[model samples]
Target chain A: MQGATVATYDFIFNGLGLREWCGESVRSGPMTMADLLARGAAPAEPQTGFDWGALWSLPFPSLDELHKACAEIPRSRDLTRSLEAGFLNVRESLRFVLDPMTQPLSWALENALHVAVNTPWWLMLMALLVVVWLAGRSAALVGLVAAVMGFLLFVDHYVFAMQTLSIIFVCAFLCVVMGVPVGIAMSRSNRFQRLMIPVLDMLQTLPTFVYLIPLIFLFSVTEPKLYGIAIILYAIVPVIRLTDLGIRLVDKEVIEAAEAFGMTRHQKLIRVQIPLALPNIMAGVNQTIMMSLAMVVIASLVSAPGLGVLVLRGIRNLELGVGLMAGLGIVLLAVILDRVTKAALARVNAAASVARH
Target chain B: MMDRQVSIAIRHLYKIFGANPVRALEHVRAGTGKDALMAQHRHVLGLRDINIDMRAGDITVVMGLSGSGKSTLIRHVNRLIEPTAGEILVNGENILEFGETRLRELRRKQMSMVFQHFALLPHRTVLDNIGLARSVRGERRADFERDALHWLARVGLGGQEGQYPHQLSGGMQQRVGIARALTSNAPIMLMDEAFSALDPLIRTDMQDLLLELQTELQKTIIFISHDLDEALKLADHLVILKDGSVVQQGEPQEILLKPNDPYIVDFISDINRARVLRVRSVMDRAPETIPQVAGTVDVDATLESVIALSGGDTALSYAVRNRDTTVGYLNMQSLVRALVPTQAPRHGNRKQEKAQPAASGPAA
Candidate 1:
């Protein structure tokens, strides 16, 4: 309190009357040895030693730290606390609007997890191979998927790997389903794209922990949607951004040709823009899958089930073997997904360029 | 073969590209120049007071350098780019007042366009691209396949129909574009620099193909180009633009013989005039008594062929025949004189020049 001083910023903010929200009151006097001794009646030993080597120190609470300890100016921490409070104040309203809208997402994640875990390992492997074949049309990629699944099975991490994958599958699918139309809407309108870019930039650049803090307050930890929502929010950005970019980047001459041929906006979008943009969209999907895997592991901090759970347990119990094995399992799963999607992307690229020749 | 009339008539068409086009239109109407309008008001005057009557069953070529707004003018006929102010009449109907549904109907059923870049859809096969306008109208492939294939064969792309656009050379791709336009069966075809992207030999071939098609189809085609030779070859009526305004427009031969602007003089300066000027243009109409002639040449024969016919003899004269009917007499001397470019009248000398212009004409 004795160190409190009214700086110019404090005077300005005090004139603005922001003290009630964040400011502390100023004390009556500055500190001195005489005042300390008079108040406590303690005897002091005087040392008349002077240090000549002293450099000129800055005044207390220099301009750089003016807002740190001022009475009238709001501190950085207080400003952030108020921001959190403002968001919390609307939490009930936000939940009321978002809960029923998002309850299906929880069910989708839960059912997918349940179905994946209960399916016989061989059947799941067969189905995964079929999906891989369908996406890639490459026998080598299909065999790669089979080998990765076999390795995970042999390591006894099959169930945990399935859990992580099932969650990723549901989330990434939902991201594409929801993100593409939003990206289309953005590409069609300049104002919408302008409005969405900052939002997308913030979603991409914000720390994973910052958003998780609010989600934890908004939903119960036990809710499957807590992590599903987290994974979706973190992974959906690339797909949306790339979809918009892809559509916008279609050849202007082609677009003009479409218009000159009297194509309706919808007809042009469906028949021309989307077909041409498919390769870029597929690349976005690949990035989204990779991002979903990354976010799922981080989401394990909030009780998201998967190999991440084993990794968490290993960390808590200090079992290096458990941690390393789970880590290897996640890495293998990531490689499988990455290679499969990349193979599919290559197929799309080839088809697109085949005609370009 | 068919009655020719005005197909697309653009009147006082003005297009200013900027945030406030209406305000800029005021400056344009006040006769503010294109560059000045840009410098003073930050608005691009894309087109200014363009009035041209594109005739039915004839190719009206709009020729200009890039940014002279020839492209902009063509787009306006299709309403691809809207005008800041104007009237566009197709078959005497003002298209500028048409609603979106009516405009779409007009575009879908009455007009189709060819592009400079041969903008065939890369994803679609050549046949599919040819059938695009019909497909956009929700027509089944079976419904248009016969007609589309007919045009495909007509454009000499029959076997290549299954190939993509990129598989075709630039000339071949534009042939596909032409086939697509023909398959639409629209009477009005807008070609925006259609043959400009082809090689010289291919361009000549395309020009011949277009002429051959025009003789058969007789559609009202509006062609845009920057090349004077192509314009002379293809244009039934030539409209030349400069700085977003029409410098002069008329029969190509008439414009060549009587260029009204210095800009046009410069544009036609380097042209091989002997190849483009015609016997009919430099001939005297219905002489009282037929003069001694080296030969009779077709009314449409180029002066170059006529020169070769007379062996460059200045004393030789030829009778001009229009389909076996003697229409005029072309003196080789006047033909040689017509080969010389017309002098562009400079400022303050126009009135004096106009008083003496009867001597400079090709009429003997």
Candidate 2:
């Protein structure tokens, strides 16, 4: 690691004369090879190039091969530096737009997380039971939620799990609120749909960890929006897609009949399209919620406090029992949320079918 | 009387379906045929220069086969399909020039359509379905429910208000459709193959009910049908269409008797004339000191009833009465001549068999 840092500075300032070509570097201090290596938290170098103690020493794990590869890489007209500047500029420009849009989400998440951690354990548990019972209208679902939450409490993960739930609830609600109208707009116009589908595809196909990286650069880690934005972007795809599909799949004759009856555009959308699209929309909401929960765990790496933070700590300290208990708590929370939402979806379908009959 | 008070008038209406309708409209105006237009330019000519004056308080039935654009023509009245070029006037006001608000008002308050598939919303109750137009007009449930219930009962669906469309049979659903159309009280009702989807028996019953309702309501009805018999029965004015152009148009009886186009002639060739031709159509001026007949047939009675009353006596003469007044006289000779269809090629043999049935069986 020491040799690599010395070579990097030597190539940049002396061997390449980069100081004369590109001006002095923006770095403030006169960083030495040892200081740079220490700051990077790099691994210690192997004393021997051939470690006969290891099974696969032929596959050298030093930067020698990487240095040779870098030498071969063309630097005649480098684009990487300019590209990085461009990306930063873009991120700066988008801040004005994204900050306002994401503020409500930040507020909801902070307040909910605060309340969840501050409230008494019994109070929060009772509140969760009431909410589950109201949504599902089922005693069994209530009992199941109570049991799962009770176990989390017993394992000393109750507040952490609650914080995760609070984030998920806020993210999922915002996703539905924002996604449904976008979907409706897509359903109304084919051109709009064509424009939006590619963007949605990119969002959904992006790796989950990649979602946090750009967000981390774009917003401060201390700001609630850093993780809030990541969770929303990761989870909003299903709701928008299903909503557009549901509205598009409405029967043509039904639409024609609506038009013939002199229904206005808004009336038709509300009374005919949305009512018929309830089942698909509800399913989308369920998927969005599950995706949000999944993202919440991953989002904790960027300062989000939850059971995921405990899991991260366990991993850092190599504590097997702590990791297992946190993982179990997350699983239980997942089941409770899934069952409650599924029950609500079933009720919606029942009401729709009854209306149809 | 309604002939003088035209309710809806379609003038020079042309509907050409394709990317470039103007180019196709030029071909249609140049007297291009349907097949030629399609083959040459990949355009479908839906209607060509259609001109029909739908009278107030009368049923004008437009009859044609599939792809003849009868449905297209009826829909054009409501501007459901924008015409390639033309004008539709409702009550002397051009509907083609109507803006969105006016168009919506026309659809909501002036014209209500009955679709062949009933078009009842599957998600709504029967009463709600009937009140759709009213509801779209922003009427409250209480304001329109009574009218819906009234029409529901009138269509013999009184006790089934709370039922959904899927729970009803095809015929019953159409009755709900009729109730829906009437509940709006739209003066011009456009029925596009309204009874075509029902069983024959239920269709006949619906036709009878429509005729019964027409007697009192006197709503101007523009009924589109592919059945010649249904057209002849229902239409006060019949328009025959073929390949998107009008082949003939007149009173149903006149069209049946003096079909100008061979296509019109062939279309009515298989019609059972005796069932459709009324006594007033066959009756002559009543002669003074008319002989007391076996029975006085009403002027509105069908020729089949007259044949039954005569008891197959071809020589018998009957007094045709309009209520208590003797309006005209019907002799079996004229009835026989009317029965000998002008379109049939072998007139002698066919007339002989028809006379044989007319001779012995009718009177009971």
Best by lDDT: 1
Q: What tens-digit string does per-residue lDDT give for candidate 2 at A51-90?
A: 5654443334233322322333323223555666777889
Please, what are the lDDT tens digits per residue for candidate 1 over residues B40-159? Answer: 999998988899988889999999989889999999998989899989999999998999888889999999999988877887889999999999888999999999999999988888
The lDDT values for all models are 0.86, 0.83
Name model 1 segments beyond 4 Å from true.
A1-89, A353-357, B1-3, B344-364
Q: What TM-score, computed on C-alpha atoms, does each candidate reach?
A: 0.88, 0.81
iRMSD values, candidates in order? 2.3, 3.2
* The best candidate in terms of TM-score: 1
User: Model 2: runs farther than 4 Å from truth?
Assistant: A1-77, A120-147, A150-156, A310-332, A353-357, B1-4, B269-271, B286-292, B340-342, B345-364
Worst 10 residues of 2 chain B by lDDT: B355-364
For candidate 1, the per-residue lDDT at A7 reads 37
Return the clash pairs for model 2, or none.
B312-B359
